[model samples]
Target: MSHPAAELIARSNRLGSDARNTNYAGGNTSAAGTETDPVTGQDVELLWVKGSGGDLGTLRQEGLAVLRLDRMRALVDVYPGVEREDEMVEAFDYCLHGKGGAAPSIDTAMHGLVDAAHVDHLHPDSGIALATAADGAALTRECFGDRVVWVPWRRPGFQLGLDIAEIKQQNPQAIGCVLGGHGITAWGATSAECEENSLMIIRTAEQFIAARTAELEAQGTHPFGPIRDEYAALPEAERRAKAAALAPVIRGLASTDAPQLGHFTDSEVVLDFLAREKLAPLAELGTSCPDHFLRTKVKPLVVDLPADAPVEEVVARLTELHQAYREDYAAYYERHATPDSPALRGADPAIVLVPGVGMFSFGRTKQTARVAGEFYINAINVMRGAEAISTYTPIEESEKFRIEYWALEEAKLQRMPRPKPLATRVALVTGGASGIGKATAERLAAEGACVVVADLDLGKAQAVAEELGGADVAIGVQTDVTSEAQVQEAIAAAALAFGGVDLVVNNAGLSLSKSLLETTVKDWDLQHEVMARGSFLVAREAARVMIAQGLGGDIIYISSKNSVFAGPNNIAYSATKADQAHQVRLLAAELGEHGIRVNGINPDGVVRGSGIFAGGWGAQRAKVYGVDESELGQYYAGRTLLKKEVLPEHVAAAVFALTGPDLVQTTGLHVPVDSGVAAAFLR
Candidate 1:
């Protein structure tokens, strides 16, 4: 049977994948219970955000940051309108970044205001189709009708809140609203419901666009056209210079707390498209949708930096341009504000463009930029299509500002709180001082588990255990789990300290570089002793204690991907891990009678700054593999489906699943935490 968490994850994945496949840069899911707002000390559960810059496939619980809604509402009510907006943005950003969590999505306020159990935001291609058109609101209304409400495009931040509030007051039962020329937003009492609505909106938009495009094509009109020579001849040097100058300015506008900056310049096609005169009028018309304003911004900033300008000079000019823009923005705000209006909340720009360089969408978070980039790319295509049909007509400028600056829209910035899933568990991990083991230890502790760290490095183990600061909860047990006596002592100490052993994670193992043919008996025995014998010894001993207490517990073996897949030089290590996997199955089969569960979590090469794949897998080892040192990690990462290195914490989550109530009926199972590398090798 599938675990509930696993089922939720599987379904969540489908939603996230569909969003990205449709051209959205990213998507997120958030949760909350009644929580006290950190800023206002009010009683309300702040929803948890999945955060920016994260892909759903690898996202774990830690990625979701909490925000206290009551506190947020208090801040909104207590502070000046302008100050409240800034505080909301700051508080949300702080909850995301300052709390050492992934940055929350820029539209967190939108999710908060929905007063729903779950929320999801995305920029689907179909949605972008109508959003990029001049008659987006009319088109959406004709298609979605009462199912969706249309919010005019706003720049985002404070303006977005203002717009959303207006819509809510008008339609109390509205499921969600689409921002003209921006993306779509959906909310529900559960994650499944939210996802369903999101899909409904996207599918509806797609079907509408498909039919409309087909009709146009039948009439001998195409949506997009090929780029002409005149539009494509922009110099690359000018583009490069433009990106160099804009990086810092873009970074500044995105976050006040984050001083770090990295720039990814655009492709030639993107730069060429931005250089067109049609770009200005199209941008003034508004975004493909309003929510997209938080991602791509209402429009891209056109830089006129010359190709011959020095990189430094170009950067300086970009900074100056942003300053001028901000001053002009203040003037625009003063000109438009009424007694009821709130001033601008954040400095994030819609999009920044250098004459020859590509565009950058500055938002409160990376997810914002990511989604905006997706919308921008789609919008570019829309413009090309529009040129094919007639110059792309988009929503009006004033409406865009209204949506961007909506009060209710800005309210989406708050986040909700969630309970730790592993709050009462006690975890004992072997090899917990360094590498994958250390990372796993940290993860378990962070999830509210009492962790006993056992390692060969007594000092490191003691330090980590002590740092955890729960004398009764965390302890350092220096023991080579390969020795039955040592393993028993560690198990005994855990029972004595934490009351009982709830989990035993056998993660102690080491790698050797010798090939199967060249392997020595000594090396073979060493691997067997630590990987196979040690795991069995620890599991049996822990199982005995768990059985006595009459509380079924979890015994997890940290196996390796090599256990299932054969490779040239990993014979000794692979054979031992393979045995460990079998041991787990046997333990689960036998110990289930005793109410003890056994499982395994197999991990791929967990190399990132870890002992396993560090130093190019070490120069000496690389020489034996007959590959360059630099190619070692890449060679491994390249083999994975997602091209992402499997981290130790990824394996820890598998351990959590194997041990948690979610997998109560599951036993003797092996979960491959590899990035589909096993399947790749099998194929």
Candidate 2:
């Protein structure tokens, strides 16, 4: 009673979950089955393949596009000569088995041509290492012997499908075909057989590379070295500063025709590859396979890292380097493009490599940018594997051009869904380990912004980040906002990990419940130092980075209702809150011309998860109110007209509204998030 398509979905998910097998929607799987047509009351043959832009790991029934096999097979003869990509697409569109289904993958023709019940096509790193080498066909023959078919590079379309079908017919015993400069296709009567064969081929390649790497290492010639050692040797602050300075430069340079989202990586593998003496040549050999053209482009831009230079000087030098890279890309496109090729897109580099710092990947969305980063890391391994065995050889320039400019490939990008409102933007939250800060960070990330959690407790900050999301969308930085140096470093870390600072939530504060006459100078100074001085430093540094990016941003300070309605015996906390509120207005006036909006949130009785309640201030205030500590939260909630307890989430909502598009034109405003505080309402 098991469905054939279910097996394909399960096996596809298994392959997609492993990065060694594929990276971000790069691989696909399909199955053939017979189903009774409800309308026609007749049995029909169908091909269920992964739909366009669907992730196989999370794929479901709806994610598969069902096509009529007979109708699809008929199109093989319709385009007898060089296949017209557009006409072929139209043919597939008309061959859909049902009225409503996901768009079929561009490889639908290739999948239908295989005479098997199950098929899996994947772009594994090990497979790509062999597919792109000059002697790739010979290597394929050696690994799988006669069981594999070797197809020369062809643009992936009708012609490619025809060639594959011809090869299968010529050698009926072959289990799979390794497409030159493309990927591997393994098919069998069952999904298990297909998966086993594919993994076997991949394992064989991995063993070959390991033996070759060991042999090369014995000769004292390494393809890559431990550049992470060099990176780790530098002071942590210096490392962050360099990465921050370099990320914006690379981002600005890569944005030739449009703004790009850049992220820095210093993983051991990435740094090791960057540290090579002849890295420029190795990096310029182009992508390892044709499928990667859309993600990594043809080649990455390599620029020198002036770690000690001022940011302005570094930006100037990088600008010149990027200009040259753009010109070179344009020339490369012109040399290989045919008369009928699609019009060229802009010449922005998708990846940027800095020797002393790290690698940076650029894209329109954070997901795309992260994928580019992943592909580059995989490319390094593929190239290394090739060099260890023989010489590193990539696909020819002309073939790379065909794939990069293919109309079918371009359509994939065009079909991508629109990004979320805060997509590609970065946010920083101080004291984000708990309380309102933690809530704000989570909210921003949910809206599609990369968040940086900065707190004095590094472990707590890191834990909070992990809970919200991993390092991809959220990172943790240990920061003492009271220290200027720490504040600057924290901002740099945010900029380095993400592209730049687009939004900042200044929420780090402390409360002391001593009477004005009994409060010591230390208590007063401590409150002012953290609330007033800390806010000033974080805002100043964040503004610098925002101005440098030439993008307007949002800055929100977590002030308190005490700023307007000071209770007896709370002078230190009340005075500091009032000072910060005034500072917000001043900052708003100064930063408005630069597109920066400064705002403040004043909340009352936010006892849950708040440091003021957790740190015994609530107990002291409860005593003054002649109530137990447990009753203080309810007492304050009841004081508001709404009689609703204002939790940390409520304050976070206010912060989002001010920073989001709804208040794009509003600034220098103090929003109340205290469940309708009557006395503290803004005039």
Candidate 3:
């Protein structure tokens, strides 16, 4: 019942959904067939190849660029040698069978040259491991015998297409070809045969790795070191803090002139790789294959964690290391670049490794950074597998340079859309698990800020992060604002997860309503600890990271209308909030010199979704006003001029306004979000 092209798309989607075969949109697929032209009523050969930037996992008919096979095949005669990449691209555009308007994959030529009706190409980790190993050709021969051809490395373009065609001519019986330091390609007369052949190659490579791993383990020869018990034994919170402490320093060093977001990974595999004794040498050897050159640099920057050192000392050492890294990278680029190569870009290392801590991946966006981290994690596994059998080998530096500087690859990077207003910025919100804090975090993320949801309840914080789009948009950190250690750790986590802290929302507070005579010393202490003292500790720590980054930032506090208008039996809550109001004024004056803006939002009667209104607090407050619990929301709404009950989202909008460009020049100001409280209006 499906169209012929639909079958090819379904087959492609199946292969792409498995990350072991491809990540994001890293693979390509094509189907060739004969279709009658509506205009001429003559049968014409057509090739449907995956379009540029199209994800195979979500591929549809429209996602494939339909090209005239006869026209594309004629390009081999037009450009016989390594033709200018731009010229070949122009030629491919001229061969479009229809006005699909989607750019074809750069591998279109290679697909056209294969003498088959269906073709599939993928960058499977298992295949890359075998292809990049020192004895890759011999291993290929051993695995598939004469059924597969082995092709040496060449930059992907017209020349690579010719090389593949020549291999096929020489070995007509081969089912597929293993590209050295690249990937695998399989072709057949039908989609089923193509899929089966691709799977066969992948399964064969997986079997080879498994058997090799077993043999090494039996001989007591291990490729990776034992995981660090010290790091593994600590609680998750402590482990996160320890690793986060180095985030800013590494991010600062890894940054180029262009801005980037830095992401940290402390997963089981990342930590184990970091703890390896030979980390520096192993990381410097290069990426597992040339395909990774676009995302991760040829080598990662290796540094010591300096766990016991003071923050200042760590910064100084990391600064020196960063300087040396840039110098070395520029030297390497100079040594290998050709005279006709495009100007160098992205000289900074994409990955940074710290022994006993974790690995940091950098990218233009959080998702890209996370993807780079995932790729490196795969690289670690493949490198281990290759080394378990023999020495881990990677492509030579010259080949790495060619791929990294390839014009077609550079075009992909240039095509990315401009960043959002708050792109690469980080925001940390206290008590971010619910109410105003949660709303503020969500808003910041919607505008492209990486948000840290800090709360006393770890589970609640994590749930909020997951709701806000997981680690790429939000990372939940369990932070007891009353404790100095937890406060410092939370800030460190934000800096490590992103590059640095650019926004801080001091919104973590609790309310206690009791007559002055009935208020216990314990209740008073708790109120001040979470409100006044807590705000001070969080603000100070956030200020430290912001100043270290030397970038101007904004800090907004969620104060209360009761700060100025006193209410009976609300001394504990009102007094603590008043203290925070004055503290904001003082902090504004002090932090302004460092280009940090300090402001406050005084919101009133925000009953809906308010934690203060939950757990019988609203009923208790209504009782004091001689009203039933059912009428509490209306009672508060009627007190305001707008006759509208202030919601948490309304307060979140005010926070955005103060931190956005509209208030770029405004500081030391308090914005009200109470729907017009006449008594609390600023004079």
Candidate 4:
């Protein structure tokens, strides 16, 4: 016998994996099957419906809310009507089948009340286009004839489920229904039939939209009206540069309430939409789908500037538009909010659209931001099709406000896990593929910061980035710190990857253990170029972005004990270290006004996992001390006040400390990680 549970899982994955069938975590599926009762030792009818807060594409047995089918249907007896329908969600616990504790979703009532053995509820863009059309009821009749029925909009709850059940009974021949101002729902006697009916409805609607769009093109017309050249996308490189430059400003404004990470996309769909004449007016109407608006906010802030506008001009207008958007959001909350409503969430816009530039979406994490951008793209597709056929109409603003501020939604937000200390921050570490740089990247990533690993070797940097978490939380950039262009590119990469730079680790350097007589001009310049000049370039470029973001940042330098103490046969290296040490103080004094903190770490001998040491410097130092290469760490430790050998992780921990909250107010300072080199103490 075929297992209904296994069949249901396969069907859901098939539909949910495709973006056209449903959005991430936006739909639910259910299977009515027989489960062997744990206590009664008898077969019992059960409904395996998707649990709350789960993506259908990745649904598993643990994410299914198992309930007694008979008990779930019994909820109608005390539903208390649509006004008090939210109460039914709490009542679902009583319907759970023996320890079925996956937390039933609000749609549980819908799956149980329906007479079919299998059902699917999805928010496909094509189906929603017809549903949100002014003539959606007529459109449904035209598309599916009597096969699919049209049901008026009603929020999902016990009442809506009862309504759908009534519709199904009245229209015996109906295979599915077009939900007004929503999406679609389909049901069948088996999982296979139900999956077919769902796909059939989606495909018919898509064909209908495509045919209508073709008709418009035949008549020299467009759903979005004429395309504007001034709003067209710039060349890829130029647009990316613009996005990199403006992301920090938009992110800072978006972070008014809490820090936010950003994602930028200038895809063809986004560019084409921006070039349309209806871009402004249609955008002002806002998204119609609950899932889309929940992530994108009710509406986006449209930057009304030509694609090639000057950065200075764009910034001035963005500042004015951001403040206006906040005021508008505050008013919107006040207009519909009830005394019983949850407190106003942030008034900041989650999505910002710039003509000719692209879209910048903000969220507390990179994944959320990227998803928000995707949801808006879906909304755009829906609007285009709706306009091609009939006038596009969304749910009322008052209704949208109710859903946006629903108490249930507020509770979901409250249940979110606490973020890591550096969760919203982004850090860039130079020479991050090896040694102290790699250790710092790992440490910061562990603390929840998005890391940008920069090194001359792209492969090594990429490997370290992949180990850190790939593009979601970390990325690698091939950067030769000595070059001004590469330094600029690396900073731009950080801005593009994660909103802006919050912390910078200037750890790129080389060592040359040579006395004054042995040191040549070439030796001195190489050390100074990588350590002194390189640190300056990275710091200067990062500070520019930090100031642009207006979010205060940290810049750390990995200097050495030799920077202060007179260590023998280390003239070239010591001179460059001294230059880096002073740059920390100089940059601190200059950049303090912008809230940029600059600090340094002076370590004695980090032998293990030290790139400088492995590059022949360790043996040279060991020779100078008359000790074997393996005993150099011991030699360096015995000379210190405390006989403790320093390692790369020790330097990494110090980097965390200086950037973390404990020393937020301390800057222009150097922390010695040399175990205890009393002679290297700051005066």
- Among the numbered candidates, top TM-score falls to 4
Q: Model 4 segments beyond 4 Å from truth?
A: none
Off by over 4 Å in 2: 36-43, 98-101, 209-241, 255-260, 305-315, 330-346, 389-393, 396-402, 456-464, 483-489, 589-594, 622-650, 665-667, 673-683
TM-score of each: 0.40, 0.88, 0.87, 0.97
- Cα RMSD of predicted structure 2: 3.7
Mark the 10 consecutive residues where model 2 has the least summed lDDT: 225-234
lDDT per model vs. reference:
0.64, 0.82, 0.81, 0.91
For residue 416, give model 1's deviation from the true position in Å: 24
Clashing pairs in 4: none
Which window of ten consecutive residues has the lowest lDDT sum in model 3?
225-234
lDDT of 3 by residue, 494-583 (tens): 877786788999999887778899899998999999999999999999888777666678999999898887777888989999999988
lDDT ranking, high to low:
4, 2, 3, 1
| Candidate 4, position 439, lDDT | 97
Tens digits of lDDT, candidate 1, 1-683: 44323433554567766543245435556655554446666665556666655566555666666665665544445445644565556566544322636566556676666566676666665665565566667776888887788877655555465567567657867777776555677767666687788788887766666676678778875454333333343465544433433343455443332211122437654666655655556655545455455456556655555445566676667667767766665665666666766667644455666555566654322334445555676667656543442346565655556655666545554343343555545578999887777777777777767788998778888888887764634778898978898887787556444434667889988767678788899989988998888888888777765654444578888887777887667788889988998898788889888777888887887766465556333564567667787676676678788887676778877777777658788888888888888552422
Candidate closer to the true structure by TM-score (higher is better), 3 or 4? 4
The candidate maximizing lDDT is 4
Local error of candidate 4 at residue 112 (angstroms): 1.8
